[model samples]
Target: MINSTQVSYFILVAYFDTGALKYLYFMIVMSLYMLIVGANLLLIVVICLNRSLHEPMYLFLCSLFVNELYGSTGLFPFLLLQILSDIHTVSAPFCYLQIFCVHFYGSVQFFTLGVMSYDRYLAICHPLQYHIRMTSSKVAILTAFIWLYSVLATVVMMSLSVPLQRCGNTIEKVYCDNYSIVKLACSDTTVSNIFGLVYIFTVIFGLVILILYTYMRILKVCFSGSKQTRQKAVSTCTPHLASLLSFAFGSFFEIVQGRFNMSRVPIMFRIFLSLYWLTCQPLFTPVLYGLNMSKIRIISKILYLGRRM
Candidate 1:
């Protein structure tokens, strides 16, 4: 149970001054939110309906899309409301729930990406073993483990955060982020900070390095294969690799910038980084998987034509 002080609600300070800017911000963010929700939901539905997309890679991608939808929703809707209205306050219980969902879903996504990297590694480097190793049952079990791990990790993090006192309940950002939430705590957060650093290194950084290494080995093996086989393999992987690079490198640089207290950087740069993390995950998740899937592309085209008609 969270202490009363720790459970205190927060009021986010909106950035807009003019009523016109507020309205514009509301419309833009609301539109983006709806787009993210609709696109991800559509992708999930299409993937489930199409038997051709039942492979482990598509399965992992679908899981990632779902996580992005949940992760973004945890904060976006409330923040959108705050942007439009003068009231930026959130209830204490709701705030903690938001924190839990954000962390849990985000971690699940990281794990799913790790799973995707391994799937690609097997498909590219060990084509003979891919079928045996990534059977439907094994994929299902791996996905289950990812979700369970995410839940356990979230429990530990949420428990650590529950003791902080939030007497002055004001946050600078548009959303309830971990750094901002931890900063307001009256209790000593030294242990939490240390734990966060450890978690970041072990889970986030370590997984990223492992993914890169696996991909490199896969690439080497792919290049050594017959030309036709190599071309086919590259076609299957190149898009996913590009998407991963955009996601990982962009996030890494932006996080380093923000963590180093580079907030004094241009407002446009700050907003770009904020929206990059906010929008790209949802936007690219569906697009990457959909593009890689010919069946999905045909279905999307049919849907678009129907809408137009």
Candidate 2:
């Protein structure tokens, strides 16, 4: 089934048929990328500079922002460059790296969302034990584990892609998503497809279930608390909930699109889907962080005043 004479590089046909629309597309995407980068960077700076934000939630918010920043870089920048330059070709090694980074950061997003859920669960369910359970060293270890496991999971997905030689050179989307790339394999991908399905269902789906269950319990605990405590708990949980909702829903849409045997989906729809997935995590994290942290609000006020002065 393996062929040695197959293509070594894939020509991504992403957004090529747009004719005059390509320029408009580039302008829109570049603007969104700038907004994402700027928002995430601002949040990171605020969290780092504000001593009052030295807490568990803000710490995880920082990690989420970092992951989103790296993740977006792993994807959007190269694609944006290519789109602008009208270059669609990608080398095999670079293609593999693209797949690795996509899945790696995708896995990290799921894991970080799960961590955020657990953080909220602890804060709402056991307010007194929250600090003790989520201690600085413990948070460090959990963050380390998120990075480690993300790499391992990405390794599994990436390792499965290397040996499959490319017969055709056309990739449908901006980035080299595993399933899309694997479909072009000259060899059998039955095993790799199965492995990917299992990973998605068990690792990614499992994380989603855990997050939902944790949040449900958190909501129960909050409702059972005193009025003031309940209000405070609701306020604390809102940002995490918003992030989880966006991540989960956007991911669900992507997975559904991937699984469905339909090529008839509009190119514009595909483009928007890619744009949403790339932009939402990076952009929303900062908004959620600023809303959740009083220190960030205070810092923003001080900056505004300083600018005026």
Q: What is the TM-score of each candidate against the true structure?
A: 0.88, 0.91
The count of backbone overlaps in candidate 1 is 0
Pairs that collide, model 1:
none
lDDT per residue (tens digit) for residues 1-309 in model 2 = 334235577777755666777788789778878888888887788778878877878888888899899888887788667876756788877888888887788788878879888888888788899889999898889889999988987787777777776677677777777777777778878788888789878877788788879978877876777898788877887887887788777877777766775468787787667656667878777887687767788887786697899
Maximum-TM-score candidate: 2
lDDT of 1 at 208: 86
| Clash count list over all predictions | 0, 0
Most accurate candidate by lDDT? 2
Model 2 clash pairs are none
Point out where model 2 deviates above 4 Å. 1-5, 303-309
